[model samples]
Target chain A: MTIKNFLYVNRKAPYGTIYALESLEVVLIGAAFDQDVSLAFLDDGVFQLTKGQNTDGIGVKNFSPTFRALGDYDVTKLYVEAESLAERGLTADDLQEVMYEDEDDDWAEKPSIKIISRAEMADVMAGADVVLSF
Target chain B: MKFGVVVSEGPYTHQAVDSAYLFVKAALDAGHEVPRVFFYHDGVNVSTRLSIPPQDERNIQQNWTALAKGHGIDLVVCIAAAQRRGLLDENEATRQGKDANNIAEGFRISGLGQLIEMGIQTDRLVTFGD
Candidate 1:
């Protein structure tokens, strides 16, 4: 197997820098190339998938809508770090939409995308053919 | 495997540089070739020779210099990003009439063309940013 896997890790707040935005763009491009793409939100990166992002208050354009488009790009695996979400006081409900939705917020959902610990993040990188972080 | 590293964080404040070094070492240990490392945005700080990290610590600027010398890696600093961040090489420093210089020894100052080239040549492009 060629293992054309791409793991895009996002690690910044939503608005301040172009990191999050550019990362999403790259994911779309990867999917267009027919690669197996997975997105991991870690650290402050979880903010990229956070719900109720109000960009109107900041006078900048909103980017939340673009995230919903990931599914359209065939980006199926969306992993969020449980520790990061706990630190930010965010539950799966606080997120808009994800690869596998967990209504009960248990350890498993649908295909079980793994709401992993920080230690497992390296595994995500280890399996990936390419790891692009923002 | 060939690799391209995207560094977008400043040297002293973030873990991007440290991660880049670790990734490069691991790749080499795994028997991979690093074709090019591209510094963009705030990453251009790696080229600033003025960095003085206290004698007690491993100066990051010097660390990168040593890494490049040891591995013969291609270290590229983005010119636009460098100019915006006040980093100057010998030519730019003279043209701008700066009194002193601080960009590290082993890295080459370049443009986004290097990034595109690396993208085309490398098997994987790993990025570290904040």
Candidate 2:
């Protein structure tokens, strides 16, 4: 099959609901195929990338650590909407530093989360061949 | 155009399955191809044969089963999600050492690759969720 752009739009928070974790499972599984896969963190989805998510008290599995493993899966484009972060009173500092090894750039480590404007996020959405929301 | 659908919510708790079923029906009536419908999260619960609702209300699982049988569409419930929520087919039940299985007719347990494949192969991918 031809490689298609699979944009996974995450709009929910990490723990309070199951959408975030469910979406992550799809992303990890989708990485097995030969396709252009990317993730968009908007709304409360940005919370999925925040650091030190301890879920022991809530009795839920903390799957936030799995985001770091995305880089190993070669699914690295993580677009975080700037407006979403601002609206939630979160800055880039509030996000976890997920890094990927740039294969073409001498295998250098680079940040996966690209904080972009709302306009750019819209363009990213429009340019996708298939947009999967969760 | 070919359409791919995802039902991510359960039957009565949310209207996602209903809306997706209706959308698929409308698409088929208009002579469009709907090859697959992937069920994830609580949506996987839609594949249980044991779900008995009020006699007056609509039978959600049966509707999907019949529609899939007529159209030869794939009704895939994610294995990971199914396992977590205790929704199992006979084979899965056997493999997992369970006594019984509740997978409805015309539905199968599969992986998320099917969902990704649907996105790649179909002209459009539609999601019905909360």
Candidate 3:
């Protein structure tokens, strides 16, 4: 099987609809296929990574933790758009620390999320073989 | 280049169908090959044969039907999404004990596996949604 570059674009907030959760579902499944998967958080999608997300009042399952586990599935290339974060008045400190074990170095865990410029995000999108946007 | 198009919104209510149609048409015009167009979420509604828009307005279902007919493209509606939205095919309607089937011509109800297959098989998988 060819290892295609799959870019899963998240442009929606976490709870209003099922898109965020479903998109995460696809990512988990896609990872099992041994594809090269990367995730981009932009626009309202930046909210998905906000720390201390509580769904107790919303009645929906809190799926924010799932994003943290994406690293185990080899989906560690998370790109959070800087412009989106700035527009939302957020910084890297406001988001959860998503990390993956680095295979090259005796399994030392490394930060998986990368705060990238919107222009850099565009280049990332252009380089993808397949882009699944939600 | 092989293109896999995914439409995830219902017709009229959103511009996803229109954008997808135009994108597919442009891709075809540009000599690109579109092997499949997968409809998911509310997009399953796009395959319903029961929709009757005003005569003056463009028929979204017919537009997809004609595109599929003209290019021999595979129009697949996600089975789970279709079932939730009541867009059943003959087999599905029979299996579910439904009274009728209303899947439009050129559109077949299938599984989410098809969507994954498209991503793996095609050169590109472009999604249009709300």
lDDT for B14 in candidate 3 is 99
Which parts of model 1 have CA positions greater than 4 angstroms off?
A: A1-3, A98-114, A117-122, B10-33, B44-130
Better of 1 and 3 by DockQ: 3
Error of 2 at B128 (Å): 0.5
lDDT tens readout by residue for model 3, B1-130: 9999999998999999899999999999999999999998788899989999999999999999999999999999988778877889899889999999999999998877788789999987888997
iRMSD in angstroms, per model: 5.1, 0.7, 1.6
Q: What does the lDDT read for residue B101 in candidate 1? A: 66
RMSD to the hidden true structure, all candidates: 7.9, 0.9, 2.7
Ranking by DockQ: 2, 3, 1
lDDT of 3 at A87: 99
Model 3 chain A: lowest-lDDT 10 consecutive positions:
A23-32
Question: In candidate 1, how many Å is residue A84 off?
Answer: 1.6
Candidate with the larger DockQ of 2 and 3: 2
Between candidates 1 and 3, which one is better according to TM-score?
Answer: 3
Q: Cα deviation in Å at residue B116, candidate 3?
A: 3.6
Error (Å) of candidate 2 at residue B111 is 0.9
Q: In candidate 3, which residue pairs get closer than 3 Å at backbone N, Cα or C atoms, i.e. clash?
A: none
| CAPRI tier of model 3 | acceptable
